[model samples]
Target: MVIQKKVGFISVLFIISMHSWCQQQINLVDKFQNQKIKAVNRSITLYGDQRDAIELNAENSSGIGIIEDLEFEKGIIEIELLGENNPGKSFIGIAFNIQNNDTYEAVYFRPFNFVAEEQIRKEHMVQYIYHPEFTWRKLRSERTGIFEKGIRIPPDPEDWFKVSIHIKENNIEVYVNDLSEPSLIVDRLSSTKSKKIGVWSGYGSSGRFKNLIIK
Candidate 1:
């Protein structure tokens, strides 16, 4: 019908737009720049946060704080981070293609749980999450082993360790300390595509991060 043809044309245009976006050259990783970000939590402040380094003070509250900027689709995102033992819920990582802090794909680490005596807690070390919809809770409940898995190699969970995340199309590979192999890999990104990039932390969790490079 006529309506069907119009819909098809619109879809084609959208696809073309996305293709152009993907090809657009951006060089944020070349230098550490103080870029602007839309924080998911207004209560959490980043007044002293820096481009080469960032320390978040959650003020003893729990919630996801994200940076809604970067508009990164695919490439490598690497950073060195140290999660504080106090305020103690360590869910630190990067949230990409962030529609918002509440809506995005994030691969975070639960350092406290990394070396827990219990296997269940150990299994919670590294995770892939889709906010507001499929959290680590829902992913554990329904998808089970698909979205989250244990880390075989444990770096000083509380100390600074480098993490490198490589994204290509719908696939994402997470590299912890060791870059030779991925600690976790996701076969699918979002149908919406990943555009935004930011360091994220759970509520009450404070962290120190540096050397963020994206190419």
Candidate 2:
């Protein structure tokens, strides 16, 4: 009887430990300052007069706004993103495990492709890539359909949508809005070193981000 009681006590402690280890940390978007991010070929600005979010506008090439104060390894990242329906001009999403401005793994969305009628366009809605090596062009030409997928139920390309990315070890799962199922799942193609996380925008893209939550 005593042994059983001790085992039960251990189980309770284990649950408590796990819960504490996975506590969620919410970032106050309005409190972000321009100086807190390192912008690369992007215009960083506060969005809305309320300043409740940050915006990134890319120039002629892909750009990123890396949060200089934050570092992430593996956890759940949630953020609200807004973009236009401009074809090939509204690519936006999150970048993680960023080694630098030119190196990182990212999962970005082509907003215009959200509800595309063409099968080929729809399949390019969400993309996963590791820079300086595995780019979207190479992935499409070599491992087509493996790293990108069409959203089962597309969201409005010009509206605000929530994205949740789950990173665990070498695997990443992307969830759009409150969907019970992941929109895309892919294995990490680069080193799993802990690094900075940031907002990403492709050429000619403008993105607004807010309400970042890390767990």
Candidate 3:
């Protein structure tokens, strides 16, 4: 009986240790100025009153602030994003399974479309794209509703909102503001592989991101 109890305790300890090892968190606010982040075509600035967030500005084209030394193939990626209500601008989201500056899969949001009166515009609230091949333009023209969809509950475009992305194999699920239902779900256009992840901002857009947790 004593031997069995000792073995059971050891097994429990091993399970807890393995769980901790599998979970990883990136300290975005504390490590903003460090070498952990590599910017690509992005002008990064510290934002928020507490200065706990980082802003990405892209003038002419899309930009990404890639997190260095971390490669993720699947699991959960959660972050808080803030974008302006400026129509035709303000695109903010996350890019993962990245291969390079021009190759990766991304799910972005057009905050201005969140509460648009036009049904067509509202349906464009959230989008997914595999860059360099399946650009937003190509997807919108070719696939249309297959890649983008409207949010069930709209968030203020000018304020912060929590975004949770779940990636499992070829399936991707996105939840906004802790909603019970996902805002969007789409099969990844690219093959599953381990690569870097980044905070992405679209053309002529400026956005703030914080509380980035990867699990």
Q: Estimate each model's TM-score.
A: 0.73, 0.87, 0.90
Q: Would you list the rank order by TM-score, best first?
A: 3, 2, 1
* Model 3 ranges off by over 4 Å: 1-19
lDDT of 1: 0.68
Worst 10 residues of 2 by lDDT: 25-34
User: Evaluated with TM-score, which candidate comes out highest?
Assistant: 3
Across 1-215, the per-residue lDDT of candidate 1 in tens digits comes to 99999999999999999877655333322222334544455233332334446555554533443443455777888888777443247778877777754678878887887668888777777888877687778988998887777777877776888888887787888888974878888775375554667667776676665666666
Clash pairs, candidate 3, are none
Rank by lDDT, descending?
Answer: 3, 2, 1
Q: Count the backbone clashes (under 3 Å) in each candidate.
A: 7, 0, 0
Q: Model 2: per-residue lDDT, tens digit, 1-215? A: 99999999999999999987776554435335536678888988888887887888769988988876676888889988998888878999999888878888999999899879999998888889999799999999999899999888889998889999999888899999878899899998987764789889988888999888888
CA-lDDT, candidates in order: 0.68, 0.86, 0.89
> In the order shown, what is each candidate's alpha-carbon RMSD?
10.5, 3.3, 2.3
What TM-score should be assigned to candidate 3?
0.90
lDDT of 3: 0.89
